[model samples]
Target: MAAAAAAAASPATAPCFPSTHCTRPALISLRFSRRVKVAASTDNPSPAFNSVTAFAPATVANLGPGFDFLGCAVADASLSLGDTVTATLDPSLPPGTVAIASITSPSRPSLATRLSRDPLRNCAGVGAIAALRALGVRSHAVSIHLTKGLPLGSGLGSSAASAAAAAKAVDALFGSRLPRDELVLAGLESEKAVSGFHADNIAPAILGGFVLIRSYDPFHLIPLSSPPALRLHFVLVTPDFEAPTSKMRAALPKQVAVQQHVRNSSQAAALVAAVLQGDAGVIGSAMSSDCIVEPTRAPLIPGMAAVKAAALEAGALGCTISGAGPTAVAVIEGEEKGDEVGRRMVEAFASVGKLKATYTVAQLDRVGARVIATSNLE
Candidate 1:
């Protein structure tokens, strides 16, 4: 809840887009069987519930060297921060119509209003549509209401949270039969509104814990189990500003050097291994080693280096830009050290960077997105 201002990206060679650098083993697509017919039943042709509300946790994409391929959920007892989506089915409305009834943020109303009402331009709307499409429910209309908790464009996976919550909420209202990965794809449909098909944020927000996006063509995801004893503590410093995903991505070079590529590949492997083994020291060192994207994006964030150095000096294992820019994450050994690292991060931003910043201390969220509430309106 403390306010302190802070800010890093990738080391791909040939100036390649960070996503393209994450090699895929294959580029196959999943094919579904022909649609099936459902027999009418007076027992209950409609879903059991009229409304379903879901909560999706915020995520940190990239996590240093894992650019566009790695991310983890950020959750804490006091920081139940994310986006919530409530979906209500209206049988009387025309088929194939998804309406965004309202979007509101009790804490930040202006931001809520800023989001477009169009389903294609809005994450929650797109999520609902994708879910319905997956369920073959074109005959029914669903009204979506979004309650925003995470700030938009703060590099905390704001769009992904909203999209994941909407996808989960809609699926729950429909019956919750969709496979987990199917639901994730539905969420990914919404993420396209942000620019590309990157799932570093979307996958982790939907699956929880730490997620590695192995491929996007067939859309494969692998969730890694971290050591319980390691207990990853995160200090997130976000400035009162906006760094659109498109702008940040545009800042990347079209390619990178071969030498940079080799170094980046090695560091990425090390970071992944560190996470799996619960080696805090190794994880921190590898995370701070992003040579490509972070360097290009550093000038966009004032005092980025100073804030990162401050966090390290305050006992943080490593610090880097959360995703895009402006929001910085500091990995610490234990929850007890969160306050010190966070304070130093913010102080550095304000004094050295001259930017006001706010931060929160949280642990990696293992639960992902889920239906928090449901109701029947008879």
Candidate 2:
């Protein structure tokens, strides 16, 4: 049933266009889970509470060399670039059921219409259901309403943000009983249902900071903290072109030589170390050193090399594709540098790629998903 539902819901399974590049497998098989000894709290639940709203920040995944394992949540001061989910209990519905009431994007109204409302197909619905199952709650039904703040296929962890917000909102509506890891697990399941089975995006969206998925089986996550003195700023310039996650995954090389693997592994380690040390320069250098995935995927995005070069020339510490493609992220230390780097990147996209682009300056979002509001029935 799950396989059928996933196949039916996944756009990657649809027939590819003659102009599209489709080579690798449509689906990824890396599943994630954590074995936690602590059980969810069920005592003294808020019986009167019936609704909750949660927001989860957008994430930059891969971070250069740490493909499929590293990610970090990012947001501007107002926290405007993320997804919101509202979970409301409906007693009239059947028990243990989850449904999507609506999906809307205030910024781009038409984008919402393309999304699915079916609980089995929608990320928010699947995430809510997974949370309920994790909490052992079977007596209540949930109706989810999703508000998308991030653009789809922009390499900003859009799906994961929605899934994280939904899981966090549903958990809060029931009494906020689930542990952080369990919340991540719920989001992971939702991401698996829609995108692929990877925790890099979901984990950081739920737990915040820089998360490294140490293991997939018996999933383990390591959060790296930034040094207090360092203030890291990211200049994210996204072109109008859409690079589907599935297609980007397909573009990746199936295998790499031993030397390249070792080089990438070393750079990944350096990235983690730089993050811990709060060295923006080293972090940027390490991020741009991704030889395998980046090289294979760069050609797929028009003007990518020029954009990266422009960023570097404009005083960016380093620059690379944010996740999949089209959204080039440049690292800088100061806010002023962020603006300059963003301008250069956008110009490169317009001149070289001939694609209009927009840029935003953001910082690391330390807090992941959180409940923004709650309602109690009188």
Candidate 3:
């Protein structure tokens, strides 16, 4: 069952905080009934397992004009395009400690080697620690093993995926008592340590579907509904280039003209409305209408304009850069259309940008982070 319960709250519209601030918004209060069913009481404090494995899907943040306020989880058909984390109780380690056992990526071995093993420096470890603190469990230490399925700096929420998976795995190892909001908060803390204090990527990765982060100071999130008729497919073409989140963020304009802000705000609202109305065409159109951030960052990415144009020309509903991308994402209606649009975008990258590229076709992942396996102590 999905973690969040249906609740009503007005959407918040505060701009993102300055880069120096360490504090972030909190997720609105909502209990996870599914977790509550299995929560262990103080009298029966024994853990449900000694080890657990969890998966969190890759995510596309910003969604064009939404900036740091909107994101959605996405996965390929096999659901093999995200991060997996395994957390195990280690009695030998010091109590209340979280450590990284290994970081390996079967798909991107070189990228895996680049990640740090220090728990405080790594998202997975930090996230596990955050979850443990939230659970008030310091009886045993945790050893984390992270398998990266997505490349870092791909604008695919790589760090957020690891953090979400680790947070879920550690929480489940103790009995899955943490509410969905707390899990998201853990992911946010991890992101703040590694990326920035933004929940756009982590929230969707933890809760699934499209999430609208209404406010950062008060930490309000509204999980947008996906209409049944919205059969949207995303074609993601990632070029052989690095566009780090820090660098992409630095490329943003410090201030936007009032007219441009109004235009982009309307587009963001239209995109949200399109999702609620199940209008795929409008969703695509609204997603491609971002004028401020996109315009500022597009020039930094070679062939981005051509790639977007090519995707549209190849019958994509709309095309834009995913996250702080070198990855160009296009929205389409069907698998076949995704294939064609992906091919054209990749070709544009190679021909116009002089860079090799790869593409993945994915659907929205409604279920967020989840445990795939567990082993109990004898």
Candidate 4:
């Protein structure tokens, strides 16, 4: 059943027009060219809930040397912090079909309206459909509504949060039959649709805390332990502009020198060791040793160099671009250090970079995605 659903929702059959680039804005309309169609199996007749709501945290991907492989969820779930998705089963529509009613953001109405409304085009909508189809609970139709906390194209795993929340909510509404890994895969469908088929951001957004994509062939995810003694904090600074994931990925080099590959591997190993040992200083220092993608992408974000230097000077152990460009992340020792680093980074962006930016402090979220509420309407 899951295989059939995955095949139907596959991106290979999804539409893609010839274009110069695959930026986020450019890909929004492209999704309308295809639709996910599945047959409702008669064996399963489970009663679905009238409504379900779930929340997922924002994640930071490509933590330093662990490009396309590492990420962690932030614990904050404030209105402007992460995403919440609510799904309601619609009695009027046919089974095996889903629709998205609205996409809303507390701060950015224009951006919210600009987001795609089609289920095939929206991450949350696709995630909900995939989860329902995977569970074989096809007797009910549904509408998904997204409440955005993370800014679009802000390099904060905004799409992953929506996908994770929607998947979790849909699963809960149908009795939560799917296991955690299956839910992760459901959310991954959205990532594959919008971004590439990478699991760094999706895994952490669903499983919580720090996740390492150990292998791809078998799709293994290893969740790292976050020891209390580590005293870790994150300072995130998002600029005013957007850095589409497609463009950021396109900037990566097709190949690298043999020695550079060896160095990156060594740095990744050291950083993993530091994380395990709960050494904040070592972890911070190791995070700054990326030699491959960061150098090439750093120029796209104005004042990247100055902001990183300022963060380090203000007691940050290491600072680097979050996932792509435009948003910068700093690893600090504690809350005080994070505050100082955020202030300094903002100042650098204003004085040196001449760009206004917003900053926030967050801890590593251990709970990935969870159902916040459920209702059964008569």
Worst 10 residues of 3 by lDDT: 5-14
Which pairs clash inside model 4?
Answer: none
- Return the TM-score for each candidate structure: 0.85, 0.88, 0.87, 0.90
- Candidate 1 residue-wise lDDT, 267-376, digit = tens: 98998898899998998889899998888877788878998999999999899999886799999877999998998889988987788998899888888898889998
Better of 1 and 2 by lDDT: 2
**Mind giving the per-residue lDDT tens digits that candidate 4 earns over 280-362?**
88778878889998888887788888999999899888988887757899988778777778989999888877899989998
The whole-model lDDT of each prediction reads 0.75, 0.78, 0.78, 0.76
What residue runs in model 3 are displaced by over 4 Å at the alpha carbon? 1-45
Candidate 1 Cα misplacement greater than 4 A, ranges: 1-46
Instruction: Point to the candidate with the largest TM-score.
Output: 4
TM-score of 4: 0.90
Q: Write the per-residue lDDT of candidate 2 for residues 1-378, one digit (tens) a residue.
A: 011111112211221111112222324321211111112325424443678999999999999999989999998888788999988887655555566777789888987777766555566766776776676665666778899999877888887898899989988887888887888988887676445678998999999889999997787999998987778888999999978777788999988999999999999999999999898889999999999999988888889999999999999988888888669988888677888888989999999999999999998888899989999876
lDDT of 1: 0.75
